[model samples]
Target: MTALPDLVLFAKYPVPGYAKTRLVPALGAAGAADLHRRLAERTVGILLQAGAPVEVRFAGAEEAAFRQWLGDGVRLIAQVEGGLTERLIDAARDHPHIFFGADTPDLDVGVVASARAELQNHDIVIGPAEDGGYYLIGMRQARPELLTDMPWSTDAVLRETLRRCDALGLGVALLPTLADCDRPEDLARWPQLEAPGRCA
Candidate 1:
């Protein structure tokens, strides 16, 4: 039998003060925590429904809170202690892993399936966000340099990652762009996106 493709997601415990810090100003700490929980659940549900071998790499100061939110039958691991780039590069070392931020509730399972399919033919696949950052990144193998010195959490991230791919002569595939629910304006769309336990 063929080995199942791995789809790893990066997540945090959705704590009040430490999660989604960028939107905390608009959402307030508690509200931001709620949003993070809902988004993480939706992302996990979608990936699980897609029938992929999914792993959620949870990294944050609060491990117990994260453990409680995780349901049964999913692989959970603590992210290696480091900067964002270091953790991601470490995760990518294992499989043709795909990493996502916890904020993109609009990401569909088909996008992930498409990414895996493309990985069969390409070295790297990225789902670009409308906000100038990428929503998804998948690679056939870990290329530590791709994550080492790039400007993260900025508009230049996707551009710089692509530049690195070119420098290494890696084949690239771009997926359709999507919006991430990271700001006050994005809250308008939350009503339509399903959040089973929330007022969606």
Candidate 2:
């Protein structure tokens, strides 16, 4: 069997007051953390069910806790100290990788498969998020600089990333846009997850 490309899920340890801060005003610290945990767990479950080889690259928690939370049979890597861009660059180096955030519950197996397929022919593949960031990014080869010095949490992220790709002469493929759970307004977009106790 051909070796599968790496699937990396970038997440923070779901700690109250640290995880999903934007949603705290609405969900409270503990509630927001619970939601974060649910989303990350759900994302991992979806990929595992699809039999996609995955690695959890995380910060703010230890491996033992993550293992207990996420269960066995998954590789866990501690994120190095840095901003999101720096960590992503380190993870994507030296391998073909498909990277995604844990907040995007709408990201299904099909989307991930599509990204892997596209990476076979394209240098980069991206799934645009409704909020102007991307939900997924895949690269056949390490191109860390492509992620550097850009707007991190703004609507222009997708556009800026594409612009960077162009400047680097990287061929790109874009997948369907999806919504991620972030701000309180975004909760309206996911009715199933909006109800109290639903995410738990």
lDDT by residue (tens digit), candidate 2, 143-197:
8777888789999999988988998899999999998899988888787675655
Query: How far out, in Å, is residue 130 in model 2?
Result: 1.2
TM-score of each: 0.89, 0.94
Give the CA lDDT, 0 to 100, for residue 158 in model 1. Answer: 87
The residue-by-residue lDDT of candidate 1 on 61-173, one tens digit each, is: 45566657877656888899889888887787655777777788768888888987888788899999877889988887787888898887788988998888998999999
Model 1 alpha-carbon drift over 4 Å, by segment? 61-65, 189-196
Each model's lDDT comes to 0.79, 0.86
- How good is model 1 by TM-score? 0.89
Model 1 / residue 183 / CA error / Å: 2.5
lDDT for model 1, please: 0.79
The local lDDT score (0 to 100) that residue 75 gets in candidate 2 is 91
